[model samples]
Target: MHRRTFLKSSAAGALVMATTSWPLGARTRDRIRVAMIGTGLRGQSQLGPLLSRDDVELVAICDTQQVMLDKTLAIIEKTGRRKPKVYGGNGDVRAWKALLAQKGIDAVFIVTPWEWHASMSIAAMQAGIAVGCEVVAGITLQDHWDVLRAQQRTGTPYMLLENVCYRRDVLAVLQMVRAGLFGELVHMQAGYQHDLRAVKFNSGNPNEPYGSGAEFGDKGFSEAQWRTQHSIDRNGELYPSHGIGPCAMYANIHRGNRFTHINAFASKARGLHEYIVEHPKGGANHPNAGVKFKLGDVVTTTLRCENGETILLQHDTSLPRPYSLGFRVQGTDGLWMDVNKSIHVEGKSPAHKWEQAQKYYDEYDHPLWRNYAAKAAGAGHGGMDWFVIHAFIEALKANTPMPIDIYDAVAWSAITPLSEQSIAEDYKTLAFPDFTEGKWKDRKPIFALDGRY
Candidate 1:
């Protein structure tokens, strides 16, 4: 759809949503009334603790599964918190729309699957409510583009909750980088390496904690079903931000530079495809794998920023290994590498290698740490989760610019389809869309308020 027509439709949808009743009272003056959608694994498991904060009021909950909603509400009730009204059954968007229409709700949290991310976020923004969406914010490249436009048209703040940016070690690296300890920040390497072939492919019978039957079902089902059940590999860097977040900080992506081009390549997955072929009942026999992926292992994507800085992002869910983000920043002055816990320098300074690298690291246990770190400590992916949420809230409350604004969301999320396109074209380099219109070049990097630098 054209941008204008799509936006008009979205605006109409928002108008319909705004007609619902709300319970705005004295209580809402202090708390940001929030409604959470999709209370499944990520929602209840990792996001629940972070959302149940004092500054926010969990007013309503929506889910496809009634039992999951009930469990979530029960937990809230047990905590002596205000129990949220539950909505289930067909058309969760309508239920959430009603919640958004209500005057009681100031914001909506979208914990839904990747498919619903764009629509839900757009709906919330149109309904005059701020939105917080999980990582890699949009589903398609068009979705990412539309979201940025929607945010602009509606003037509602939208946040992509990239929790990895607030990791303790990552935050420390930012501080050191700001101190010129990391030098010119030449290049970076990071990744989210996780193996889930068995569960993903559904090997050895069906294991469903929520229910029965194989999650992917038979191979003749629907393409949509496969998307949810299988790994998020529609694009090469479909999940790049887990690694890109830390890398972006070191490279100063939104601060002064931006990703210029990206080239991605997927390693031969013939071995994995053959394994699935040999063991049809091993879970890979499902219709989900009908004919799409015939490859085996890794999908490595390389991003080239405007300043000639490069970021290497790699992910492979078909392999088995402990989750590790190989984060390293190779700067011109000094280098901070988490993989080897070493620092390299090429200046007229002390030849500090292993010993000095230890000193370079800062312990996140200070008084200011207590203030900013308390709320963020409970966030998923270490503590980066809460920081993203809190920062967005602070932006809305204080009427300040979002720490990671629409431009950042677009730039970060652009890796999704861009990398996919690159990989499809045999790892051809694709120029990145200038989401910021070069505005980020005039902005300064947002540093932690803890005075670490």
Candidate 2:
């Protein structure tokens, strides 16, 4: 079947499901009415727990592709949960206006592809709904600017759900950083390197993987798609936040300082070209096999923060290697390194190495995290996800400040396209667009609730 026709059929089926489900805001419960947009693999598989919680109500679901929508609806069906209204449109396709029009929805969880993050988020915010958007936050430099404007204009909270910040080990490192164990954090390194080409593609039958439910099933896209078929030769830091999150936390990024400027460098695209040329399946017919691709496969960006702190952000997607976030932090008084999983202190009488790090650095108790850890622990991202949601709901409940303010979301996602521009210019340094208008300098961590270790 044609992709468009199949998508339309799935969309109609979704409307049917929505009619059968409970009406929006039916019970008048205190649950935060939430909606899931782009219910693809990541949103369906991972977002289930958060939506299922009693604290929130899933009032609506939207997606451009029908296959994913059906999969998401099935989850709602099995849980006996009040199913949400479903909408389908491809890339600002159709359901957005109607989805945002739902007055019952208090917040929207956007898990769409990188391109649509900014516009969809802006639309939802303008509709008076808080937005929790997926990573690669903004697609273009102007898009980043537009998102901040929308948030400020609407007074709706905007959050980038960068779950890496909540990973178990990353949290452990944050605990240490909070205690001043990493005193005067100096420089850091972070990156995301995971090669999935072999596992992402099946050599034999193109359509062997069937069923949306199967782990390796259709997986949504066809084999002819770009991300799977094309080799990422000289790709600039493809996935950066796995390293950026830990680095940002260690450097006290939002508390006072901010990233100032960055210079990027990318390796030649020869390796990926060779693979496309040599692969038996498609030799001369391969795209760019004979013609060289301009972009490099690996890109490393060096950043200098407003406070003179330096950081290294690397991206290597072409080669096969074990996944590593490459998190490391150094401070004036002490240092906590993820690669070593060890902490070092300046005092001569260093009682214990790792123990000392834990005592001084990894003590999870913080004035901000102490109060909400229990409630947040049940959510995803090893509890951080809960914290993020807590901050959003609390802002609505108390009319207080947003945990991750509009500027934070803008800054976190701005790196997506800016990094790309840096690579295009032969890794020349690119000045970061200041979304805060110099206001972020005084910004605190926005830690609303206390966290206990």
Candidate 3:
């Protein structure tokens, strides 16, 4: 069947599995009724903010693990807020569907695993609930397309909760870019280069220090329970949005410019195995030491944009390194490198010398950060999480478009699967699918125009 016909015919059957009672339309409630799916570590981070906001009412929460659900409830209890209906127990993985079926939920925050993001977001959009989804929108090229189609068909609000785009320093760079400080953009580089060896392996005990054990899979805790499996199965840029989202905004991607093609290469995959063998809790005889991780120690991807700008992204985990996005924004006149925290502009600094980026960042600090610094004081991820969540809530309340909408979500996320395909094809360049379908030519840049959010 045709794709659209297939969607139309199949949507009804899908909805039958988790039908919402509320009719599809704009809600008139004074407070936005919210639901949370996957109340794990990431979900808990978002819960504090949702609970703190008087304008939001967390109506329900869902997670398969009783421990996670209890942890989330305790967080809610501390705030003295009315407890939300709990879902998920007895190994019911589909508890989120029941949460979606309930009435009075105006929006949902999906902080589930990478694989569940697309499907849950689709279900929420189909149910006429706004979606505040975490991280790369989906795991595959088709998943991205399906999410875009669902939002387009449902006319529901969908925002990718990528906090890095709102990171204070990133926003400062964005301001500099808009003010023509970078001159005409030429090339940009960024990546998720933080060492995650410990994060990929952990003891199942929540009380133990995280990342202190070399156990994974059924014996792992938090992210290690699932996130590590990706390394054993995938050989691409598994997580790209943390680096790509900010770059997309810097280059006005999907807003008159878009990624045209990409090529990717992966280094060897010895980092995980070596970590398993070297850790105190593990040894050469450890079972995990024998588990082959397909993800490379370093995965490099290069993308060409329609506007003649090139982007280089690296996925480096499972190795020893300080945490850094490894951001480098370069143009005709100047460049900013985050690793060294320095910026060099033509004629603005001593010849062939780098200036401290602090002054520049201070001068170009984004208005949002300036206005909300006090309110966002402790909201995780260096306060950027506050900004992204604030944006989602404000847009939903005002019935306005999201700063980082569905197109941006899918575009940044599609890089992962596209890069995967490229590597599988011997690093051959592949055409970047236009999720916007040519609408990018007329789409206007609307991310963080002012301090409104």
Candidate 4:
């Protein structure tokens, strides 16, 4: 099928699955009544962008810790916007459910811990509200399936807030793929390669907070206080979405094909542990000073798709390294590599040579980015956060499906647990779950396909 036709078909499937109409307040074409289920760093981070939009209203904010909740409340109160119903207190585990039980909220942004991702999204959908969730994949393999089924059964929209998928450069590459600039896609590589020594070691430190705390966060990391725990208890591709989101888009995963299997392996753990030993913080005898991190410093995962395309994903955040997604897309006729910011196309470039990728930016930058590039200025993470939030708001207003829908969200995020299992068995190759169950082969694109939303 033609690409446009495929897109329409994919949209048709979403329409059939959607809840027939926008829920509650959104049905009236009024400002979107949004509730925030977590008030830590990410929740407030997303708040800044949403608050800037006149199309959305902050109706509620919830968090388990009272200090953090009040800090968020102060943020909302300072705006002098109508005070949203606040939920949660110190040790309030049930606070999120109360936020969902609210009657007028049109949608919510889930920026809580990884463990809450699937459950919160599922509950929000079941409550007839839409969801925009932060990502690191899911806590467990079944978490992905549950999130998908909840959207299908409830017909409410669930979008994984994968900013990388809509990234300016990545979208340009997608334009190239669709235009046949990269002929017959064969392999791709990407990874989470940022050094998080400061963030990981700063966890639990009163002076040096991590997660929601470090980057404008007042309360340090919240939720399960979880990141360090993962380092202590397990290892192996724990955060795979950053690497896989864009790669999946290039490969057309869960649309024309799916990941069939993955073989994963990890190197010895050292980064965070060594950081603590070298630069201890907070108390002179900090508890982390004695803790040994179980997570490996580096993890590499290789996946085979049903359509013969291969993907290499690496998780290297805990180590010391310069930041990059490590993006590279190779095909029968051409290739593009991110680290060097260059591309080489067969017959189009000098023989056996590399050319600056910037040469094609003017002609190939995705239209969505081109159009919103100005407004998205200074938004965050190279304006990607702006584009993604824009997509969510636009989808809400138009009542169209999300750019990164449930299938895409789950398929990309689900790689975490599946990779964990592969590493656990001493680098065994494991089959990937067909999250679409077989609907993928005949499916079309759900996100924008030709400069149109």
Candidate-wise lDDT, in order: 0.66, 0.63, 0.88, 0.77
Worst 10-residue lDDT window for candidate 2 reads 209-218
**Per-model root-mean-square deviation over C-alphas:** 5.1, 7.5, 3.2, 7.0
Top candidate when judged by TM-score against the true structure: 3
lDDT of 4 by residue, 267-347 (tens): 998776666655634332645556766778889999999999999988897766899999999999999999999999999
Q: Ranking under lDDT, best-scoring first?
A: 3, 4, 1, 2
> Model 3: how far is 175 from its true place, Å?
0.7
Least accurate 10 contiguous residues by lDDT in model 3: 16-25
Candidate 4 segments exceeding 4 Å error: 1-30, 78-80, 203-207, 210-224, 280-286, 450-453
Write down the TM-score of every candidate: 0.83, 0.78, 0.95, 0.89
- Tell me the tens digit of each residue's lDDT in model 3 across 192-237: 9998888878777886626788998889888888899999999999
Clash count (model 1, backbone only): 8
lDDT value, residue 340 of candidate 2 = 54
Candidate 2 residue 134 Cα shift, in angstroms, is 0.5
Number of residue pairs clashing in candidate 3, backbone atoms closer than 3 angstroms, sequence gap of 3 or more or interchain: 0
TM-score ranking, best first: 3, 4, 1, 2
Which tens-of-lDDT digit does each residue in 45-89 have in candidate 1? 544554556777788888765656766777777778867777774
Candidate 4: residue pairs that collide: 41-212
